[model samples]
Target: MRRKEDVVRGVAAGIAMAATAPYLTLKLLWLTGSHVGARDPKALDSLWTVNLLTFGMDATALALALSFVRPWGRRAPAGLVAFPMWVATGLLGTILVAVPTDALASLVLGPEHRTPDQPHLDDTIADWVFTLVYGGFGVQGLSLMTAFVLYARRRWAGLLRSRIGDLPDSPTRNVQRAFACVAALVALAVAGVRAYWAAGGEVGLPIHWVEQRTRSIATMDAAMAAMAVAATVATLVLVFRIGPGRRLRGPLTVAWLGAGSLFGWGGYQLVAFGTETTVKDLPSATPGLMNLVQAGQFTAGVLVLAVGAMALTERAVQREQPSSRAALSGTEPPRDLAAR
Candidate 1:
């Protein structure tokens, strides 16, 4: 069984790494002024920074895919391996869910025509670019997520099996509750805004943004909103111990992916187009309220992550107590609590 699992992990990691090549190559081409799939080469000039950032992100994904199968990855510090994987899962996972839904919606609704002023996805990018890049991202998300799950199960088997009610109450429960509440409110706000936009309510959007709305854009908005809600629900449940008998792994997985999506995509947009970027000609709000909302989403994600980390750390310390006592008394700790 172990050997079979290892083979599966290796194959998945290989596919993930293979899927990055097209995206990485395209980003590199753009960065080097080779407009391989760009409609207007100069249109990409202002997006050099965005391209570089995405390139680095994909490169990191490539490295992570390798780490998923390599023995050294097992020995790496937990945080070092987990953090990047979480972010990768967020970015790619959102794409994985959105792209197919978008395609189906497009098929049902038909394609919307856009004016020259509106920034449609195909405005600056070629048709083939979306196909190649998104297809790669989809494959990468599926394979990388699979590999990570297998890796995590091997390394943290006991934690995965533990129930939420089994965890000892943290001394900082009040603090956790406070942060969780704040994070939940922010997530709901973020979800509300995105959901409104997805449903074609355009109160806060610039004219160009409203005009540029397509099935794909709407699908992405809906996905982000769903992720925000999921994160909120999962985090609140875990923090408040709402489901006493629930396995810790389920909520943790949802919280991880949801919070990661909030942080990863929110941060990407905030950095990529939050400032004076020519990527999209968005309308001007009186005080950049939309930007603040984006920042708030990112902040909420951070709060969720911090609160979850604190809870897990407290649990880990408490779990270690029995083992430490056992060592001192020259007796073995329960096998169920044994380190993976």
Candidate 2:
């Protein structure tokens, strides 16, 4: 069974690596000054930084995929492995869920696509670019997640199998609860704003973004809002032990993806918005408001991560206490008895 699982992980890692090719190739082409899909070559000139960032992201994803199957990954520090996977999960998980949902809605709802009569920045790119990039991202999300799940299970099977009620109260539990509440509140606020925008309320949006709002964009907003709420609820339940008997894995998984999306996309946009100029044709938001929103979103994600990490660390220490005591007393049990 273990060998079979390894084989499955190897295959998933390979697919994940293969999926990055088109996106990485596109970014590399753009960086090297090949206007393969650009409607205006000038539009490509200013996007070197963006292209470079995305190239690095895909490159990292490729490396991560390799790690799942490589021997070195098993020896890697937990923080090193988990942190990047968290970010990648957030980034790719959104693409995984949102793109397909948006596509389905478009198909069922007859596109409902609206464009400004005036030319926009995105109009400068060929449609195929969106298809290729987003399609590759969707594939990457699915396969990479598969690989990560298998890898995580092998490494942290006991923790993953634990229940919320199994977590012993610690001195830091209250503090984690307090921070989690704040993160939850922030997540809800972010969700409310995104939900508002998804519903076509344009109070804080830049005129350009309002004009450029399309079904897909709205769907993406709706998805983010949903993720925010889901992440909030999951984290709350986990920290508060709302469902005492419930397995830790379910809520943990939801919180992981939800928080990851919030941080990943929030940080991505924070950078983009921070560097943006009020250049015409590009969809943007009110700079100050957007900066605050993304920053808050990012902070909330970090808080969730901290709370979860603390809880896990506490649980791990508790799990080891018995064995550690037994070792000191020279009364350690046999392997099977120790596991019990």
Q: Write the per-residue lDDT of candidate 2 for residues 10-125, one digit (tens) a residue.
A: 99999999999999998999999899989888978778888888899889999999999998987788788888899999989887778888889878888564445754547779
For candidate 1, lDDT tens digit of each residue in 106-199? 7888877667676775877899998998888999999999998988888888888888887668789989889999999999999999998889
TM-score per candidate: 0.94, 0.92
User: What C-alpha lDDT does candidate 1 achieve relative to the native structure?
Assistant: 0.86
Off by over 4 Å in 1: 115-119, 277-287, 334-340
Error of 1 at 67 (Å): 1.3
Candidate 2 stretches with Cα past 4 Å from truth are: 113-116, 277-285, 331-340
